[model samples]
Target: MHRHTRRTVITTLLASSFALSGAVALAPSAGAAVPTASCTVTPNASGTSVTIKGEGFTAPRNLNDGESTVPLSVDANGNFQVTRFQKNVDYTVLAVKEDQNFTFVNCKVVKAGDTSGNATGNNAKDAKRGAGDGYRAGRSAAQKSCDVKATPNKNQQHSDAYWKAWQTGADAAFNRYC
Candidate 1:
């Protein structure tokens, strides 16, 4: 074979291989659909308003029903984000599962200006990693049902039943964070 022809064929094959590798690298993986939230709360220096933003909720909600509240939005993925304003009062933000009519989780908002002392909900930092050990023992003993998974991970499968189990475990885990 001619040297130039051989070189051309080799280069073409290399380019094709590189292109295929790049395509595969950019493709989304089939097994990586678990939801996670990087939640954060930012209160203004005056404490009149607080910004709450995060991702990875079954649905985003605005527990506030008062006047002049900022609207929250969820992206294509099930993530919620909102900021609210009030006259230096604490806020309890609850993420309710609209379809299942259950509260998924609670967020406590204490604005910089808040002084009325109405804050509630567990702090995210104090939240326990697993609720099974303590939660299951108490619940199963009382209900006589051990069907629920004791330790429900944050990224577990999303379903009404799963959320119910998680809420059960969260009752105790929630207290740990606050």
Candidate 2:
């Protein structure tokens, strides 16, 4: 009876060890491929803001524009968007995931009223252009705490659309930043 009990104990120990080894073998390796992300940049007709749409990024991502980083959450479909990004300058937009994996794309904001097309679209384009210009001016004004001298762009100062958008932008910026 003693011999039988000892053999049973040894067999149980060997079986447990084998099971543990198998589990380790089935685990994911450290070298597994990291997820990738891709994005498309669409600058509004008015060059003031850009909409960045991305796919294949993991949850809890960040959009970095060199000067600042904005945290973003990927939706269930693994997609995200950064709407109304205010920087007008051209730069590389970096999308970084929580795991330190990242991807990037260059974005170019078109100058206001620079679109190439027929003459009839010029009016609408001009309005958008004016809005873009106004937004930039307003942001500048707000940055100066709305106390800066009015250095209006001679070309855009005449347009009603420009003034309207400029006021809107200034108000928005002042509310947010100042």
For every model in order, what is the number of clashing pairs? 5, 0
For candidate 2, list the clashing residue pairs, or say none.
none
Identify the leading candidate in terms of TM-score.
Answer: 2
The lDDT values for all models are 0.47, 0.55
Give the winner by lDDT.
2
Write candidate 2's Cα lDDT for 9-95 as tens digits: 999999999999999998765433234345545666666776666555556666667677777767876666677666554445455
Q: Against the true structure, candidate 1 has what lDDT?
A: 0.47
Pull out the clashing pairs in model 1. Answer: 47-112, 47-113, 126-177, 127-177, 132-150
Writing each residue's lDDT as its tens digit, candidate 1 over 1-178 gives 6999999999999999999999999776643323333344557677666766544445555444333334356566544555566434443344545562234334444444342212213323122322343355445443543343234444532322234334556444333332
lDDT of 2 at 51: 69
Model 1 root mean square deviation, Cα atoms: 14.3
